[model samples]
Target: MATFWIVIIAIVALLLGTVLGFFLARKYMLTYLKKNPPINEQMLRTMMMQMGQKPSQKKINQMMRSMNNQFDKK
Candidate 1:
């Protein structure tokens, strides 16, 4: 009976530790990525142009307007 309780406790502790470690690792990864700047818009546009894909100005303006609206709500 004593050995049974010990085994149960060990399993519970292991499960809790696993969950904590997973969350901590995820938080660290997100923080690291946020600190490192991603590629710029100009670079992305240039790359797309090189691939023969021209994004329209009207589409860009619409996207900008939508983005502004989202920020205006806050």
Candidate 2:
């Protein structure tokens, strides 16, 4: 009976640890990504210029919106 309780406690602890670790990792990644986004306005502008197009404020905003929408879709 004592061994049974010990086994049950161990299993429960393992599950709790797994759940906590998952949430912690998720929060850390979110904070990191927000601080260092994969793309930025300047990079977009540079790309457009490289492609032989003038970067305008309106185009930049549109591209940002589209990128955000795609991220939201995921």
Candidate 3:
């Protein structure tokens, strides 16, 4: 009976640790990504140039703002 109770307690602790770890990892990634976005103005400009569009400063700023707004909405 003591062994059975120990097993149950161990299983419960393992599950709780797994749940806590998942949320902590998720929160860390979200904050990291927010601080260091995968895309930046230079990359966006290069992409536009490759697509045959001459990227202007105004256009780049507009695109950046729109992208940030989209992320904010999420």
Candidate 1 lDDT, tens digit per residue, 7-53?
99999999999999999998887676556524445655676688788
Tens digit per residue, CA lDDT, model 2, 1-74: 99999999999999999999999999898778767879999999999999999999999999999987886665
Work out the TM-score per prediction: 0.57, 0.70, 0.90
Q: Candidate 1: deviation at residue 27, Å?
A: 0.3
Point to the candidate with the largest lDDT: 3
After superposing all C-alphas onto the true structure, candidate 2 shows an RMSD in angstroms of 2.4
Query: Could you tell me which residue pairs clash in candidate 2?
Result: none
For model 1, the superposed segments whose C-alpha errors exceed 4 Å read: 38-46, 53-74
RMSD of each: 5.4, 2.4, 1.1
Name the runs in model 3 displaced over 4 angstroms.
none
**Residue 28 accuracy (lDDT) in model 2:** 95
> Candidate 1, 74: how far from true, in Å?
16
Q: What is the lDDT of residue 63 in candidate 3?
A: 97
lDDT of 3 at 58: 100
Task: Select the stronger candidate by lDDT from 1 and 2.
Answer: 2
Clash count of each predicted structure? 0, 0, 0
Could you tell which candidate, 1 or 3, scores higher by TM-score?
3
Q: Ten consecutive residues with minimal summed lDDT in candidate 3?
A: 65-74
